[model samples]
Target: MFSPTGEIVADAQRRGVGVGAFNVITVEHAEAIVTGAEAAGVAVILQISENAVRFHDGRLAPIAAAARCVAELSSVPVGLHLDHVESDELFDQAAANGFGSAMYDASKRDYEGNVAATAAAAQRGHAQGLWIESELGEVGGKDGAHAPGVRTDPGEAAAYVAATGVDALAVAVGSSHAMTTRDARLDHALIEQLREATPVPLVLHGSSGVGDDDLRKAVAAGIVKINIGTALNIAFTGAIRRELAVQTSVDPRRYLRPARDEMAATVTRALRVVTLL
Candidate 1:
């Protein structure tokens, strides 16, 4: 059965486990994510971001459809989500195009505006039977906007979740977005505090920068969803590069298949680390 985002994520939280949110850049990525999840017998989230939609000419249907198809066929639970969507139109597009969940990122907006917009988006998403996740405090590392010093306040997080009625909250603890290295450290104390403050499951964005030991501790501290992108993308692209380098005249499938297989191996390993499997 296809479990809703809130249900699967909440269950994972209760079990002291974390679910992987893998960014789907192509149909191949989606396939690898779902395939790994089914093999592991764990629920997974397939995410498409605003940038991904733009890559497809503002239409999210193709990727969204592919994710939904994977979700439907997978033996394990899978949820299609829109990640870091900054516009109402993109949010609406994700909802309309078959995404079961979405994260409305207004983190760049002023605090009050972020609250209002995210709250409105939460209402809109819930009305469509979609789960909504919102971020607080910016995840740094994109163009150097975030540093290890960034953190979210427990009081503010509680208020944001209350005001927005979101299904989950993505809080900045210490990870930065788009980090090519794995030196980021999480604030385990902050994780415990935020977990105590908020009723909803907490999400950790920019997780690719977090080390495996730190990721396990974060989940142990109560983070239910961990979003990893850059790490897996690097693994996938590296495999493609390796295959193409050895056989320059090979078809795309010849290269892409190895990429997908390598990515699935990475996903499976990370899932074990994050979920304590």
Candidate 2:
């Protein structure tokens, strides 16, 4: 059944487990997410990122509708979320298109500006009856710029959540975006501190880099929402590459089927590891 992101997170909080939020870049991605959720018998979030919207020429309706269809057909609860959305217009579009929740990212702005913009966005989301998420202190390696280490201050993160009225908070905890290596180190102590300081559910973005043991620990430490993107893409592209290398099939479906299956397997493994189900 289709579930609201708030309800999914609340269930995770009650169960002391993390809910996997996988990024959906295509119809196949959406289908794979639902398949994996059903395979694991666990609830999952289908997230569409801002870059993915742009990839579709800013037309989010088709993919959003596709995800909603998959969600409705799934026996397990499935939620749709817009991830890392920076514009109010895009956020509104997601809500209009039936996304149950959105992460309004204003992390590039100054602290006060991020708070003000996220607060306004949160109000708009709440008015639309959508759950809102926002990040404080930009996660590292966004757009290929990896510099001095950046981590979210537990105190500031708590303050940001209190000020923004968001349903979830994504914090920078030593994970970098677009990491091909699964060696990112997370500060479990800080995760616990942030959880203790904030009332809302905690979100961990750029989670593809974190290993399975660390992910289980993060959930145990209080991260309820775990966002994954690159890992699925890796599985997809790797399958496509291998399929093409072995066969000379020109049919797109021939390769895409393997890709989708690979991605579903990855999602299933992640769900089992993160939720320990």
Please report, in order, the local distance difference test score of every candidate based on alpha carbons. 0.88, 0.91
List runs of model 2 lying over 4 Å from the truth: 144-149
How much does each candidate deviate from the true structure in C-alpha RMSD? 1.2, 1.2
Best by TM-score: 2
lDDT of 1 by residue, 212-248 (tens): 9999999999899999899889999899889888896
Assess every candidate by TM-score: 0.97, 0.97
- The per-residue C-alpha lDDT of model 1 at residue 182 equals 90
Worst 10-residue stretch by lDDT in candidate 1? Answer: 142-151
Residue 119 of model 2 has an lDDT of 96
Write candidate 2's Cα lDDT for 157-274 as tens digits: 8788888999999988878898888998888998999899999999998899999999999999999999999999999999999999999979999999999999999999999998
Error of 2 at 145 (Å): 5.9
| Cα shift from native, residue 56, model 2 (Å) | 0.3
